[model samples]
Target: MIRLARGATGFRGPHEAPLPRTEAALFRAACFTAAMEARGRAGEMVPGEVQTFRRAALSDGYGRVFTALGHVHLPVVAFTTDPVREGEPVPGFADPPVWAQVFETAGLRVMGVKELMTPLEEVDVSELSPAELTEIRYWKPSCLGDVLFNWWD
Candidate 1:
């Protein structure tokens, strides 16, 4: 089972996505391109652009962690998105419960692990206070506009 912290913001999302470092950098590039498009600056002619965006959407580290956190334990949880399942269905998943069972076999008394697919919208965002937001720097991350424009020469 995988567990992660997400929602470093109030109105966004997270997950335990496994992406190559190169791919992650490309994902950031795609985000910049999309932002430019929204501002009518980027033309629609970039090759392999969608692939980067799709990578960003799929392997967003926070999306993976936040989504998983809603389902997994708070602090003590193990998670993985690498060697992901591809194509047709596989039998078992490495969710919390499965990991618990493995731990039991190893002589550890695990409480329980349940699978949940609740959407990020349903998460208890109200728990985040303004002070917490400030402390976490929810606004410090790259804003879409800034991310689009900020770059090396």
Candidate 2:
């Protein structure tokens, strides 16, 4: 499992408030991306795609913590937080050891833990095409997950 927290970077949404730094918030975002990929819609997520992702994420017991908090919405822009500086304590919001134990108990190997920072620019306003933007948003988190998991291999 990858643990993420808010740092110098921040996130914004098209029609909602800024992303919170709470564990539930991070879990929800991760689960949303996971759900999108699971449904093979990792390229573009339309407004209607939300319910499907919600249902899929909720089906996984680990995601219940987020679902129980109420409705979950897709963020238009999500910047990963900056990596924790070496020798610095991990943020309280992202307790890596705790998360590692949780995944271990679930029989999942923790390839690594990552702290995601939001990009400095507005991804939504980039010159990239809409499809490209969507694809980036959909795959960013999973890409990080893959990289972290394989870093030692």
Candidate 3:
């Protein structure tokens, strides 16, 4: 099964995803775009133009360098049009679990190598390779966002 890990280049690792790297990137882009739009509609935050897009890995260092993925991962940065108190993080960046929940509520699915349309909660840590598990231990992920927005490499 595919294990999700967000990286600089994009989601990567030895895990096998159902879609190719390019397609996966595009899918993630679309999902995030829709999610941001929803957040805007709710008057929570205004979705900004994507600051950057992650491509595919070029070598063994997945998510370290750029490669020709079919699609790109649009990492959108959102902001609040209204003034906020000091020390407050941006709306979208403030709470990642909430943001990930937005995606989950929208019916977005993270595909696995063997499982079709698996939800984020169903992702099994036991399926991960020993090295990946070790990485997870190091990252100490607490929720879906941590897994999806990591710098494992």
For model 3, the stretches where C-alpha displacement exceeds 4 angstroms are 1-25, 28-123
The TM-score between candidate 3 and the true structure equals: 0.32
> Which of candidates 1 and 2 is the stronger one according to TM-score?
1
Q: What stretches of model 1 exceed 4 Å from their correct place?
A: 1-73, 81-93, 97-117, 131-153
lDDT of 3 by residue, 9-109 (tens): 23335664532222343334544454454442121221211311222212111212112111133222122223332233212212122233333343444
Candidate 1, residue 153: lDDT: 14
lDDT of 1 at 14: 35
- Candidate 1: pairs in clash: 2-79, 14-62, 14-63, 14-64, 15-62, 15-63, 15-64, 15-65, 16-64, 16-65
- Arranged by lDDT, best first: 3, 2, 1
Model 2 segments more than 4 A misplaced? 1-95, 114-153
Descending-TM-score candidate ranking: 3, 1, 2
Candidate 1 lDDT over residue span 35-83, tens digit each: 3333322112222222211111122323331001111112121223333
Preferred candidate (lDDT higher): 1 or 2: 2
Q: Work out the TM-score per prediction.
A: 0.23, 0.19, 0.32
Q: Give the Å error, residue 30, model 1.
A: 38
The candidate, 2 or 3, that scores higher on lDDT is 3
Error of 3 at 147 (Å): 1.3
